[model samples]
Target: MVDKGGYRMASGEAIEKVYYDGQKATKALQALENIWVKRDLILREPKELNLSRPSNREAVMMTIVGTAAPTECKSCTKKDGPFDGCFVVPGVARGSCNNCHWNSEGIKCSFRPPSANVDDTPAPRKPTTTALFKKKAAATAMTATAAQDATTTPAQAVTMTPAPAAANVTVGNFEVLPLILPPSMTNAQKRLLIQTFQNMIIVLENSLTDMV
Candidate 1:
């Protein structure tokens, strides 16, 4: 382990000690402000990177342990070129390269494209009040129609093209609707039907009297 120090900030904050073996090491501190890092991109000053913050101390404890590749930052390249100063802070925004890659506590710094947002989970969709109300109203209308049908009189329930007349006949608990006569029947036919009906009623009455 190569144990080293003397990494200090201009504000005189001391950088935590760093240890590096040939294969793995700790990550370097990142610039606290992006603007300062942008300015230092070309004439990169190693110490100008933020050396002292609570986050830095936390990062120092997490060891960078992995075999890093050059392609780690390749996905982040823009049309202009690799982002300004990306070479200096290899894994600051994304994947670890051979120069700066690290697996902090078994978590490798994987490459992420610059276009991607940190929180990629979709927002929860909400039910619309209008849709819910329409559904409820339709259900209510169906229920009302069912209730109206159940309670409707035969006179009210049937739709007829001819003039309609109804009579109710009761047999035990059941109620039966009389047959509807069409208005197109001739008066003579109507009189004949009435006379036949009266004759049948008289015969039924005489049979009942004999039984009594």
Candidate 2:
């Protein structure tokens, strides 16, 4: 149909269209045939990995060893088999068997058994701005505690006398400022608040120094 003069009665446009369509179909068929040939060649090639049959004695022995943890450290048996003969995958839990080196001792499987708490254990928290902030806060608290402990002592408390109530009194030319405190605040709470503020100021000063 595509010969130079085979369709002499047909229009030139019709003949050209038919000829190109036929060429496309022929190329597609050739491509399909090539794919099948390559697939066959791959299938015919000899596979090096040969897993023991599930019912075989070696396979059963491997399964037992795979399921159990290694009795001795630094020694294990090595075996290459089908994916189903070893690790757990999708529908198959192929036991704990894995490829490992062998020694004079028995087949010490190298597979590490899954941890019992694997699912319950939480992933480690990644360090972030919040983590840094928490660390700084903790440092500040520690500093405040250390300063308060160092400055206060039982001996000073025993020897110290109570001072007169805070009042506005003249100290030379300038009048003394009246000290104001919350009515409900206790001595311990007041000391804690003062220590906290001091620690915060120190932290700010250290941060500013580092920036400079």
Candidate 3:
């Protein structure tokens, strides 16, 4: 029907406007057919890989290791089968896989390849400064202990290390120590000697200061 502004319109809303994409449907059918062909090829040929059939939830993203990298291909996607057997377009490569689309540079068929399964184990984390210090300290301690063990004999295997002397015990400024005299000396003799020693000490200190 024709609209007022010279634009074209379809029939009334009652006539269900069924839009069909013929090209899209054709492409989809072709893809399905290709998949069937690949599947048939797989079934017909001997099973090379012992992969457990994946469920819808755990659909594994298998990688093609034999090729340089199949992900780089335009036609194939990650959803494509990761079958061990080669599934190339027959016209392009039938006998020789070198002519296949999957070929990247100059790589060849599978001797042994791995899957692209998700690894459950966590990746090793980089060490922080604190962790690194702890490791270094532990290593040093271990090495020292090992060296000590190697050098030490049964008789000299001491666990507790002896403490070192801190300060020298000498006379400080103007400090008087106890008068430790012999028992044979009388108190009167001790008093006289002490008085004489005090005089000598004063004289020596004065002379030293003058020399300085």
Candidate 4:
């Protein structure tokens, strides 16, 4: 069953007892605060004090208990949901009050006070097989589409002419020269050396052509 704050406490005699005690304590503290504020016994401060400080112990305790109590809307008698750590006082009661809406005549009676500031509690998480299956199916579909795209597109095939055995041997000989060269040559020097080698090769080819 729901406690005074409309929260369903754990089922047990011990829990019920604690809840009842908390409700009574909450009521008493609220009464005291109401009296103090009305009679000007406690003066409102310019700045709010930290609740954890010893000097503000009584005030803090009063605020906590008073705010924790479940308060029903005057109109709907429904317990207001906790917001910002504070309990809200419901709007004035009305005969036309429905489950979703409030019907109040006056502005003051229609509006709720600001909620108290409180610590945030984490929400519970639930596991579902349907969600897991959907995720897996989506991932599988994407993978299949990518595989199909890869197969449909042909790769650029490189063709190489088979050279004579002696010509193949010459290509391997030049490949070794780059490894044997000094590593410190600048880019300009390397380019010049390449051009010189190309000119020498052309001259040798022309001389061979003339002999043929």
Each candidate structure's TM-score, on Cα atoms with residue i matched to residue i, is 0.24, 0.23, 0.22, 0.21
Minimum summed lDDT over a 10-residue window in model 4 is located at 92-101
What are the clashing pairs of model 2?
A: none
Worst 10 residues of 2 by lDDT: 36-45
Backbone clash count for every predicted candidate, in the order shown: 0, 0, 0, 6
lDDT of 3 by residue, 75-175 (tens): 22222233223333322221123212222211222311123112323469999999999999999999998988987786888674444322221232664
Q: Summarize candidate 1's per-residue lDDT along 1-212 as a digit string, tens digits.
A: 11122222321122223322122322433332221211111111233333233333323222122222344344224211211222323344243332222222112223544344354344677759998899899999999989878867757785436565433444334444564555777768766765666566667767887999
Candidate 1, residue 75: lDDT:
28
Could you tell which candidate, 1 or 4, scores higher by TM-score? 1
Question: Please, what is the whole-model Cα lDDT of each candidate in the order they appear?
Answer: 0.38, 0.36, 0.35, 0.34
Q: What does candidate 2's lDDT look like per residue over 88-165, in tens digits?
A: 111112223322211111133344334522443345888899999999999999999787667679466334345633
Query: What is the per-residue lDDT of model 4 for residues 43-79, given as tens digits with 9 covering 90 to 100?
Result: 1223323323221323333223322224333532432
Clashing pairs in 1: none
- In model 3, the Cα lDDT at residue 114 comes to 25
Which runs in model 3 stand beyond 4 Å of their true positions? 1-125, 154-156, 159-212
Better of 1 and 4 by lDDT: 1
Of 2 and 3, the candidate ahead on TM-score is 2
Overall local distance difference test of candidate 1: 0.38
